[model samples]
Target: MNKSNIAILVLIGILFSSCTMKKETMPPNILFIAVDDLRTELGCYGNTVIKSPNIDQLAHDGVLFSNHFVNVPTCGASRHSLLTGMRPISKDYLRNDITELTLTNKQEQDAPETFIHHLKRNGYHTVGIGKISHSADGYIYGYNEAPSTKQELPNSWDELDFDYGKWKSGWNAFFGYANGENRQSLKRQVKPYEKGVVNDTGYVDGLTTKLAISKLNQLKKSSKPFFLGIGFFRPHLPFNAPKKYWDLYDRDSIPISPNPMIPEGVNLKSLHESGELNGYKLGEEKASLNHPVSEQYARTLRHAYYACVSYIDNQIGHILKELNKLGLDKNTIVVVWGDHGWHLGDQQMWGKHTIFENALKSPLIIKVPNKYKSKSVNSIIETVDIYPGLMELCNIKLPDSLDGKSFVSILEQKNMQTDNVAYSYYRDGISLRTNRYRLTKYYRKEEPTIELYDHNSDPFESKNISNDNKEIVEKLIPILEKGNKEIFY
Candidate 1:
């Protein structure tokens, strides 16, 4: 063989090796951020009133999903679906507190080998902060606390600097009451607002943000590829935040709900009439109205919620900036999502647990580094899709039992159709949302009552055309049937 031929072969081999190394090194690190009970109420999601600059900026940098619904609206069910990559109905697990659900034979106690466990097993340093599970208390989920192990309590709880008895964090403190039904007990303990103080001064969201920042700094120094899940507990309930945040907005300026005042003679569904407000009841309808909230009071509550969101956004911005400073932004994939939407006075409701869009629709923002930059996807995506989607984004080998399909194709192709309908189920009710239509069937076996709304025509879902268009209903019935078959089977 000639020396020239041998040299040419060696050059080709070097080029191939370089290309392979580049491809292998391209796998980006993931920064999965999950918020509790947040709705699609930001500037990016066409919410002009709410101030979420951090989230809006993140959306501008990457992709903001227009339509992202959770499998279930409640905390436990939604998180279970998101973590496990399966629908709540399919798993037959729809309640909070893994222990109670398991004891009552309602659902399984352990998480079904979630994406986090998968990542951990595959050599990613996984750490969860704040409320990742139904319970804010970590012991409920088998972390840090065990009968055989010594309990190393944080200094904050030991010193009793904060009102541990009243707030979720404080409950393990001096005044902790695990069985208490009234959340107002904690609400009453919070000081209206104070400036420049860390201990017992700010809301839980602020505390969570501070802790998350600390975690980020610690993780940055570590050599391992980390999966940090920072869960923010805010805009959820009690409507508490720093008084300054509440003071930011004028009460009268807060916009009234798009569908304010539930219409007269609107059919009372079993969900509403059941009198369970899905778990947390702000108050009875008559009581809420009789003690009619003044415009000032309404504004105050809305202002607090908005302030909490802004606070969260600010924290997120800080984290993102840190990621950039550490040169991790190039390899980190950031996903900011709300567990479910909250009802800020829509249909006379104030909390999640309803099957309405206001309650079920959550904001899903994904930043896939240099590879997937400045892309917006409008495909129908469920919370269950998050697991597989992350798997594909990180190029991880996903398990075959995953119920979700990766929407990575949709990221590349804007108009990709992963599924014809995004299905969501709550107890007996099932909802199917498509590009142009939303059809919901309330019951099984019996003639399923359907409500059809053309999303393009009526974005607010004001008018139900199910009764008016018999042919459309008939046509959609089979589609709904097919969707349910997949959802249940």
Candidate 2:
């Protein structure tokens, strides 16, 4: 062959090699949607009642984890575990203010504070909207106090923003009512639920949705892979939504928890007086462990919560549609996760500060381009695993300090070799959840410090057979204690 002909062939080969390399080297964009106070009671999780069509469709297009649990059940703590990939190593780590206390006003350094910071270090543009951290916005403020210029995550986001709109402050908007009045302004005199005659833009979530859609449009033109975190306010508190979303559900058909009474063998110390729900002074009635709310009132509160879920679902639909229209869905890794689960009259409780299954289980849906399709992973996974999982999914290098092991294999191969266990911490108790059992141990002076519930016969956790199941407790305590790095006792 002539030298000129060989040189031309070599150039063609080099061009082909680069074309292949481009496909492998281009990193995927991340669309992370974190909802507050959500649980496994959605249409995608086999709830025929809740009108969560958008989220259900997300499950249809990607992977849904039916057995996912959080390490902590509160908003700030659970998200801390999620963002940092660490379990409750210290009692102080379980506080909602852990992020603000540990990370605020810090200088930049090589060691990333959170996983989002890690992504930022790796040449990704991170944008945050709404309550990605403990605060409604990224700013620091008390519920009744003025806002400050401090960041909860000091080095995480490139642009941290929240559109409080007419409410004037992020905290006010979070606990807002329809008429621009909020719980703080009203001195907590307002009811815990509201149905307003406004469009989707009537609430802050609507504004957040608009902002997210606009961000997606702008992000499509960026040169670097973007990590966009869109956090929604509802289904969290005050149960406020446009009247249209509320009107979608029939009040009579709203289902309350089947196991509404206290479990058979548990002490009253394990439960509480629904302190969080009772904070709204004008609530129809307070929730208590001894005297549970009436069935009729329970359905009413549940109805309001369903409305908020539908409202948030619509907001998610808007952002997802924008992503697809901008062609970002083709290379974007989308995640729909709830910070933690709320108790809608489970065990006669109305909050998430419990070590039960209902409080710890939340919805987690992940969609990767051209990978798993319409899949459901029932093996137990925890909130701590999300950081490592995302790192592996985005082809980024995994950090050795993360507490979670990657479940990316479980995303593809349904029946891979693995241990299906999840651990949760609340109060003085440490709990473990397996495929068929839930074991909890409290470090206190109580007769029934150990609680065991077999999910096979009682998925609602209505009965505790710890005394009868001593052998099971003996077998699972070591596994549970392994996760309790800092023992309370």
By lDDT, who's the top model here? Answer: 2
* CA lDDT of each prediction against the hidden true structure: 0.64, 0.90
The collision pairs in model 2 are none
Using all chains and alpha carbons, the TM-scores for the candidates as numbered come to 0.78, 0.95
Q: What is the C-alpha lDDT profile of model 1 across 305-326, one tens digit per residue?
A: 7876766777788788888887
Clashing pairs in 1: 29-331, 164-170, 164-171, 165-175, 171-176
| Steric overlap count per candidate | 5, 0
Candidate 1 least-lDDT 10 residues: 151-160
What is the lDDT for 168 in model 2?
Answer: 85
Give the number of the best model, judged by TM-score: 2
**Model 2 misplaced regions, further than 4 Å:** 1-24, 414-418
**Which whole-number lDDT from 0 to 100 does residue 60 have in model 1?**
88
